[model samples]
Target: MMSFISRTVAACLCLVLLGCVAGQPERLAIDPRYDSVAPALQVYMERVRTGGERNAVLNWEEAGLAALELGDTDTARSAFDEALLRIESVFSDTEAAAKARSVWYAESIKDFKGEPYERAMAFFYRGLVDMWDGDYENARAMFKSGLQQDAFAEEQQNRSDFALHMFMIGWCCQMLGDYTAADEAYGQLREFRPDFATPSRDDNALVILETGGAPQKYAAGLEMSELRFRRGATQGVSRVDVRGLPAYPMEDIYWQASTRGGREVDRIVRGKAEFKVVQESVGKVMTQAGTAVMASGMRKDARKETKYVGAALTLIGISQMVMAANVDARVDARFWRNLPNRIHVVTTHVPCAATLPVVFRDGSGSVVQGGATTVRLLPAGNGFLGRATFLSSLLYGQ
Candidate 1:
C-alpha cells in the first residue's frame, strides 16, 4: 500500500513537471526580406504579426507608435484600437490573471495590459489620431479615458495628477467650441499643475514634444514577487522653447510608473511565496522525522506498525515538498519599451503658410544640435495643430 501511494505521488509530480511548468514565450524574429525597412518599424511590424493574443497589447502599442511616427494614421488607429479593446476588457477574464492566481503559475502567464502609464499613453496616441481625423469629440473622449487610467496611481495624492491629459481634454473641447467644458478642463489642470499656462481661445495650434526614453520595469523581492521601476534617462534636452507659446513639462512617465503603488495581484503573489516557505519548512522537518522513525523501525526489535507509520509520514512529506517546489510567485514585469520619458506641451496659434520655430535646449539652455528646428502645422478641423518629437541623445549631439 505504501509503495502504491509513493508511485501515485511520483506520477503526479511528473505530470506537473511535464505539463504545468511555465515556459517563456517565443521572441519575434524579423525576416531577412525586410532589411530595407527601418529597424524599429520592422521589429514592431513583426511583433504585431507574430506575437499572438498574449502579447497583443504590447505588440500593437509598439506598432502603433512606429506607424504614427511615420504618418501612418490608419494603421496606428487600428493598432491602438485593438490594444485599447484588450486593455479595457474585464481583468478577471484574462488567461494570465486566471493562471497567475494559482500557486503553480507565474504572473507573466497573463496577457500584457501594461502599467497604468502605458495604458494612458495608448489613449494619448489614439486621441492624437482622432484629432488628425477631425473627430474632436472622440478625441476628447480618448483624452478623458487616459485621465481615468492615470487616476489609478498607487498613492492617493498622486492619483489623477496627469496634467497632460487634462490639457489635451481642454484643447479638444476648445476645438469643438465647447468653451465651458474647456474651461472646466483647464480649471482642473490649473488645480493640479499650477505652473501650466491656460490656453486662450485664440490659441489654435498645440505642439507636443515627446522627449527621452521609457521607464524600466523589473521583478524583485522574495520569489521575485515585487514589481519595481527604474527611472529612464533624459538625454541632452532639459528645457524646450517654442517661438509663440510656453512649452512646459506636462508629464513625467517615470513618476507615473513609480507612484502606481502596489497591485492586488502583488499581495496574492506574496501570499503564495509565504505558503511555499511554510510548506518547505514543514516538509523538511517531517522528512527528517520520518527518516529517523524508519531507521528505528528497521531494527529487529521494532514492531510492524512502526514501519507502516514511518512510510506514510515519508510519503506525505515527499508530496508536500513537491507541491512547495511547484509554487511560482514571480511578478509580471512586461512593459511598453518605446514610450517617452517626458512630454512637454505648448498651445498657441500658427499662421497659415507659416511654420512654428522650436528650440531644444540642454541643461544650460543652449540649443541642441541636430534637434527639431521647425514644425509645419497640419490643418485639423477649423484650425491648425503642430506636433513634433525631439529626442535628446537619440537624434542629436549635445
Candidate 2:
C-alpha cells in the first residue's frame, strides 16, 4: 500500500510538471515565437537581483508577462505596480528593451476610469469565476469593469468579447432579481454585435434558458483568453503617458487620528450648493442656487475637479421641490467613493464682487474638526469656494 501511495504521489508530481496540476485550470501557454526569448529573460531577471542594477522597469514587463501566462493576477498586479513605481527611474535609465517595455507598462494602468489591459483580463476571469460560482452581482461589476479596462485590447481582437462578457452580466443579473438591468445589458449587447438577434418570439427555449438554469450555463473564459492572447500579439501598444493624474497613493499615507483635519487625507472633493448669499454683510445681499452632491478625488498631485451633478432629485408628494439644506449641514466630497459634497456655489449676484462665506466639511456634518483651509477661486458653475472641510463634506452628504 505504501509503495502504491508513493507511485501515486510521483504520478501527480509528473502531471504537475507537465502543466496538468489537479484543480488548477489549464493556463494559456507562451507563443512559440517566445521560446527563445523566455530563457534569456529568466537569466536577465536573476542578474538584476544579484550584482547588476535592478532593472525594475524591464523586470516589471517581464514579470507581468510571465504572471499573465500562468494566469496569476496578484503577481501580475504586483509586477505592474513595480513598473509604475519605477516610471521616473525608467525615464532616466538606459535599456535596449525600454521602448517595448514602455508599451506594456502603459497598457497596464489607468485612472479611476479603468485599469490596464492585462489586468482587465484578470478582472474578466475573476468575473467568469464568480459567474461559475453563481455570484452574479459580484460577477456583473467585475465584467463591467473588465470591459472598461480592456477596451479595444489588441488581445480582444475587436470581436466584441464585450458582447459575450455582457451576456454573462445579463445572465448573472437575471439570476439576481435584477431582470430590468439584465434586459438593459441585453439591449446594449445588440449594439456591440449587430448580427446577434434575439431568439424569435415563438422560440421559448432562449427565455427558458436565461430565466432558468441549465446547471450553471457554459462560460467562454477560455475562448476569451485565447482571443485576447491573439489580440495582444497583433495589437501595437504605443506608450500613453500618464494623462491627467494617477490615483492618490494611499499606501504612503500614514494615518494617526489627529485633532487637526488639515491632516492631509488621501483626497478631497469640494462642491458648491447653488445657494446665493441670501444675506451677507450690509453691502452684500445676493442670490445663489446650490447643487447637492458627493464626489471623490485622488491626492496624488493634490488634485481637485468639479462635476455638474444636479442635486439629489426626489419626488415629494408628487410635486418637485428642492430638498431642504442638509439640516446636518454636511456633504462628502473629495475621494472617489461618494457623491461629491454640495459645493457652496454662492454666485455673486452681489455686484460687490465680494467673497461669500464658504464652508467645507469632511464626511460627517460636523465642521471639519480643525484646520487651515486654502481654496482656489471657484470657477464658473460653482459659486463660492468653501475652504472648510466641514462645509465641503456637507455639500455632498446630507
Candidate 3:
C-alpha cells in the first residue's frame, strides 16, 4: 500500500500533466484536401469566432492569406486590418502586471506575435490590395506605414534595413509620377543593396513573383539528462532556419543631384538576399524543465518503498516523456504562405492592349509548368496597370 506522501506526489504529477494540457493554445483542424481553400478558410474563421481575442488575431491572419489566395481582395483587406489591430492591442499593453505575466507565460499560451519582417510584410500586402483596387494614395500610405514599422524595429532591435520596403516606396512614387521622390527612394535602396537594379522610365508594369512556403518548425536534437538538468542546461528546444528568396534584375539610371533639389539618386540598382532567425523555441525548454521538476518531486516522495518506488519513478518518467513528445513544440506554422519567397522585377515597355506573359521558374531555372500567367495591359495615365487573366493563380499559385 502506498504511503500518504507517495499518493499525494502521484496525484500532483497527474495534475501537472492536466494543467499543461489545459493551458495549451487552441489549434484548428487541418483539411485533408490540400488544394481546397474553402475548408481551410472555414476552420480558421471558426477558430477566430470562438477562440477569443488572441485567437482571433492569429486566425484572422490565416483567413487573410486564404482570402488573398482566393482573389477576394476585400475580404483579405478586412481580415488583415482586424489582425493588425488585435496584435497591436495585445502587445502594446504597458501595465506592470501585464508585462510580468507576459514575461513568464505569454508565448506558451498564445500565438506567435510575428517577427519584424512578418509584421512589415503585412503592411506591404495591404498596400498591394489597395493598389489592385486602384487606390494609389492609400497604397502609398500603407507602404509608408510599413517603412515606419521597419524604422521602429531598427530602433528597438537593431535589425538590418529592409531593402524590399525601400524598393516598394520607390515603385509607389514612380507610379504616382513623383520622379523626385521615386529617385530618392531608389537611391536609398541602392545604399542597402549595392547591386539592386532600378526600373526604367519606359517600363509600364510591375510583376511580383512569390514562390515556395516558409520553413516549417519541428522538435529535434533534444539533449535532456539528469546531469544536464542539474547543471541548469535548457538546450532541448526548437530552432528554425533563415528562409528567404533569391534576388533578380533591375535597370541602371543616373540622376543629377541638382535636378531634384540636390537630392542625389545613385547610379546603380543592386539585388538583396538577406535572412535572419525570426523566432526561437524557448517555450519548449521551459516545458521540459517544468516536467522534470515534477518528476523529481515524485521520485523523492517514493524513496521509502524500494520496489514501489522504482515503479512510481518509472511511471513518472514515462508520463513526462510522453507528454514532452506530444507537446507541439512546432512554432505556429501559420504564415502568409502564398506570398512569394522572392520578388523579381523587370523593366520593359508593354504596348497598349498587349498581353504580357509572366513566367515563374524555380532556383534551377526550369519553368514551373503551370506557373505562367498573362496580364492584359490597361493604360493608366502615362503608365500601365495589368489586369491579370489568372490573377489568383498568379498571386497565390495553383
Candidate 4:
C-alpha cells in the first residue's frame, strides 16, 4: 500500500515537470530585406517567419493584406496559400493538437486555424490574387470556397450570409462569359441582399472598396477562455461615392467575425476551469479532514485503522492539489489582425476611361477631409477592375 502511494506521487511530479518543459515554441530570425516594407506589414512578416507553423495562419493573414496593398502579388499569393492550406488541413489528429487537449497544455499551443470568418477572408484575398492575374475561373472558385467557409458558422442562421462573396462570384462568372452562372449567383445575392444593385451585363468596370480597420479580439469569462470581439468603429467614413457609377454596401467583416455562435474551445476551456476549481476545493476539504483524523490518531485512545486512513487521505489530497496547479485554462487570443472592417463594391458601364473621382462621407453626409481619390480603372480584357483601401486608424487619427 505504501509503495502504491509513493508511485502515484512520483508519477504526478513527473507529469508536472513534463507539462512545464514540453511544447516550448522555436523562434526564427527575420531577414533584413523585409525591413524596407511598410512598418505594419513588416511586423506581420516577421511574425510569420518567427512564429513558424504555430501562428502561420494568423500572421499570414496580416501579411497577405499588407502585401496586396503594396502590389506585391507574389508575397500575397504565398501568404494566402500558406494560410489557406493550414486552415483546410486536418490538425486534430496531429500530436500537437492532441497535447493541446490535455488540461496541462494551453489550447493556443496547437496550430492555429483561426475563426471561420478569418478563414473565409483568406479565401477572399486568395480569390483577389486570382483576379489580379486575370484567372476568372479560379477566382470564381475561390469566392465559392470562401462562401463555403462562411457556411461553417456555429449559428445556422448566420451561416452562408456573407454577401460579398456572392456578389464577387457573380462578377467572376460574368467575366468568364458564363451568363447563366452569373445570373444564378446574382439571383442568390438578390435574395439576401436586396440593397445591392444588380450589375448590368454591359457594365465593364468593377471597383472594390475595403474600408475601416480590423475587429479587435479579446478573451472573456473567469478563466479568460471565452473568445469575444470588439467591432471596429467606422471613424467618420460611412458612405462612399464613385462618380458615374453605382456603389453598394457589400459586407461588414465585424458582423461575420462576431456572429459565429460558439467555438468548441469554449466548452473545453470552461471544463478545464471548472475542473481546476473542483480539484482545489475538494483537495482542501480532504486535507483538512485527514489532518483532523491524524491528530485524533496521535491521541492515546486512537486506533491503528484511523492512522492508516488519515495517511491515505492526506496523500490523495496532495496529489489533487498538484494536479490543480498544473491546469491551464487560458484562451487563445491570437487573431488575424489588420483586416478591413467592411467591404464595398462599385460598378459602371464600359468606355469609362477617365480617372473617376471617389468621395467618402460621414454619417451626416459631410465630406471627410482628405478622404477622396481619383481611381483609374485597369483594363481586364473587355472590362476593368479597380481597388481602393481605407485604414481609418491611419485616416482619422485613431
Candidate 5:
C-alpha cells in the first residue's frame, strides 16, 4: 500500500501533467468573413485571431488585414497600431520576471513577439494607409520609421534589408519632394538589386499589388538527444508569379548584413538551429532537475514502493514533456498576408478615363487567381496616382 507522502507526490505529479496541457493556448476558429478574401489570404487570415492574447499580435494583424480588405483604412490603422504596441511592450519590459517568463515560456505560450519582417511590415502598412488617405507628411514619416527598422535589422543582422520597405520609403520621399532622401532610399535598393529599375518622374499612378501569402509556420520536430527543439519553419505557399497588364515589372531585392559590428556580441538568433539547440538545452536541464526532485521526494516515503512511484513520476514527466512539445511546436503562422508579393509600377500618360488590369498567376503561368478591379488614374500635377475609387476592389479581389 502507498504511504501518505507517496500518494501526495503522485497526485502532485498528475497535477503537473495536467497543468502542462491546460497551459496551452487555444486554437483559433476560422472567421467566416475570411472566405470573402483571396484563397491564399483566406488561409492566412483564418488562423490569425484564434490564439487570443497569447496571439495578440496575430489578432491585430488579422484585424488590420480584414479592415484593409474592406477598405476601412481607419480600422486597419488602429489594428496595426495595437499590434505594434503589443510588440513594443514585449521588448520594453525591463522586469526580471517578465524577461524570465519570455525566455522559458514564449514558444509554449504562443505569445508571438513579431519576426523582423513582420515588425517592419507594421510600419510599412501604416505608412501605406497614410498615403491612401493622401496624408503625405505622415506617410513620409511612417515610411522613414520603417526604413529605420530595416537599418536596425541590418545592423543587428536579424534579417536581410527589406527591399519593399526601402522602395516605399523612396517613393514616399519622392512624393514629399525630398529628392535627396529619395535618392538615398533608391541607392540602398540598388545595392540589393543592381539592375533594378526606378519609375520615371513622368509616370503617373503607382499600382502595388500584394499577391500570395507570407511563409506559414509549422513545427519541425523535437530532438531529445542533443537537447535541440526545432519549433518553426517557413511553410505553405512558396513563390508566387504575379503579372499586371500594362504594369512595369518590379525588382526583387535580397541582401545580407554582418552581425559583428567591431567587437563580437552575444546575439540571440530566434528561430535558427543554434538558438533552438540552446533553448532545448536549457529546457532539458530544468526538466531533469525538476523530475529528480519529485523522484527524490517519492523515494523518501516509508513505503518500499519506489518502483511504482518512479514509474508514475516518469509517466508524468513524459506526459508533461509531450504536452509542452506539442504546445511549443504549434507555430504562430500569422503574417501580413495581404501585402503584395509582387509590385508593378506603371508609368503611362493617364487619359481622362483609364483602367489598369492586374492578374495573379502561379509559377506555371496558369491564371489560378485573378482580381477584377479597374483603377481610375487621376492626374496629380506632373504624375498620376490611383484614386481610392478602386481600393476596395483591389484589396477585396472584387
Candidate 6:
C-alpha cells in the first residue's frame, strides 16, 4: 500500500495535471445556460489585471456570489452594491456592457424599482419574485425600457416552451394588468408551472419576448415606462425577452422521458435576442428630456433627457425616444444578456476627449470602448448610470 505522504503527493500531482487546483483558470468553453458564472468571472479577472475601482468591482462580485450561494443575504447585498458602484462609471458609450448591467440596476428605480430580473433571480424563485415583490408594474416598465434598445427580433417568436417559465411570464403580466396577454401566454403552455429550480434542461425550453411601452393592445394592447448614485430618478431603459424553454423543475426530474422509444427528435434551435425599441427621447418647449450636453468649463455637466419618446410617440412626447428597427438587433447582439457584476456610476465631469479602445466583439455583444462614452460596458442602461448621474450632479447641482 502507498504511504500517507505518497498518497498525498499523488493527489497533488493529479490535481495539478488536471488543472483542478493551484488557483488557475480552467480554460473551458462554458455553456452559459448551465452556469453563467464563468463568463462573469473571466471578464472580472481580465479587468482586474489593470486595477482600481474595477478591482473592487470584481472582488465584491465574487464575494457576493459566494455569499448568495451560502444564503447570506446581507453579505450578498453589500457585495452587489459594491459591484454596482464599480461598474456604474460609464452609461453612455459602452453599449454592450450596459445591455446586461441594466438588469442589475433596474432593481432600484422610481424609488420602487429593483433589477426586475436580477432581483427576482437572486434566488431560485425568479418567477415568484417577479410576481409578488410589488414588482410586476416595474417588470412591465422594465420590459418597456428594454424595447427602447430596439433589440427584439422576429426570429425570437416560437421560442422553446417551458410550462413553468410561461407561467412566470404570464403571471407577471397578470399582475401588471396585462390579463389578456397573460392568459394568452398561459394558453400556450402544456401544463401548470411550478415555482423552483431543476437539475436538467430535459424537455423544457423557456423563452421571453420583450415589447416596448405599454404595448397598446387593440382592445387589448397597451404599455408604459434608470440609474445612479443620485438614486430615485428613473432614466434610460432596456428590455430583454427571455423566451425559450425553461429547464425541468427539480420536482419534475423524475418525469423525464426515456430515450428507449427509438424516436428521432431534432434538437430545437432556441436562442436569445434583444432589440432597442422606440427612438431617442428628445426634449422640447414644454418637456424636459434627452441628455443635456454642455461645454467644458461650464458650471454644469451635460445630461441626456427624455419625455416619452417612442418612434410612434413622437406625435405626443417629444423627448420620448425609441430604437428604430434596423440597428436594434445588432445593438442587442452586443449585450448577450449574460455578463457579470454590473455596477453603475455617473460621470462627474465629461472627459475633454473620449475615445473607446479598439473593440473586438466578445461573445457578450458589447464593444469595449476604453476612452469615452461607455458603460458597465452596457449590461444595463445604468452601466453608465454612474457617469450620467455624476455629470447630472455636476451640472444641475442636484
The per-model lDDT (C-alpha) reads: 0.81, 0.32, 0.49, 0.80, 0.51, 0.28
The alpha-carbon lDDT assigned to residue 273 of candidate 4 equals 81
Per-residue CA lDDT of model 6 for 134-194, tens digit only, reads 4555444433332221121122331232233444455455545567876675565434333
Cα deviation in Å at residue 289, candidate 5?
A: 18
- TM-score result, candidate 4: 0.84
Q: Pick the candidate with the highest lDDT.
A: 1
Residue 3 accuracy (lDDT) in model 4: 100
- Return the candidate ranking by TM-score, descending: 4, 1, 5, 3, 2, 6
TM-score of 6: 0.24
lDDT of each residue in 1-398, candidate 4, tens digit only: 99999999999999998997795567644456656666656666777777887887877777777787766777788778888888888745788777677787778878888887888889998998888678888888888999999988889889898889999999999988899999999999998898667788888788887778778788788666678899876767887888845368798999999999987768888888888889988888888888888888888888978977887788888889889888988777777767788888988875855577887778887778877776667765557877776663223211
Ranking by lDDT: 1, 4, 5, 3, 2, 6
- Candidate 2 lDDT, tens digit per residue, 344-384? 11111222213233222333433333322332222211111
The count of residue-pair clashes in candidate 6 stands at: 112
- Residue 291 of candidate 6: its Cα lDDT? 18
The per-prediction tally of clashing pairs is 1, 59, 10, 0, 9, 112
lDDT of 5 by residue, 289-331 (tens): 6566557656656355655565565566565555545332223
What lDDT score goes with residue 104 in model 6? 20
Local accuracy of candidate 1 as per-residue lDDT tens digits, 145-243? 998998777788988788889999999999999999999999999987887778879988877887787788999988788899997767787878888
Native-to-model Cα distance after best TM-score fit, residue 286 in candidate 4, in Å: 2.1
Q: Which stretches of candidate 6 lie over 4 Å from their true place?
A: 1-65, 74-136, 139-167, 174-181, 187-398
- What lDDT tens digits, residue by residue, belong to model 3 across residues 1-398? 56988999999999998998788444444333323446546655665565554455555666676676666666778878876775455444445224223322222234444444456667777777777766667777777776665554424333335566677778778888888999999998898678866778766665444433332222222211000000111111111111122224321110100011110101000000000011122334444555555455566564444444445545555554454443322222233333333334444566664656655544455445465555445544445554221223223322
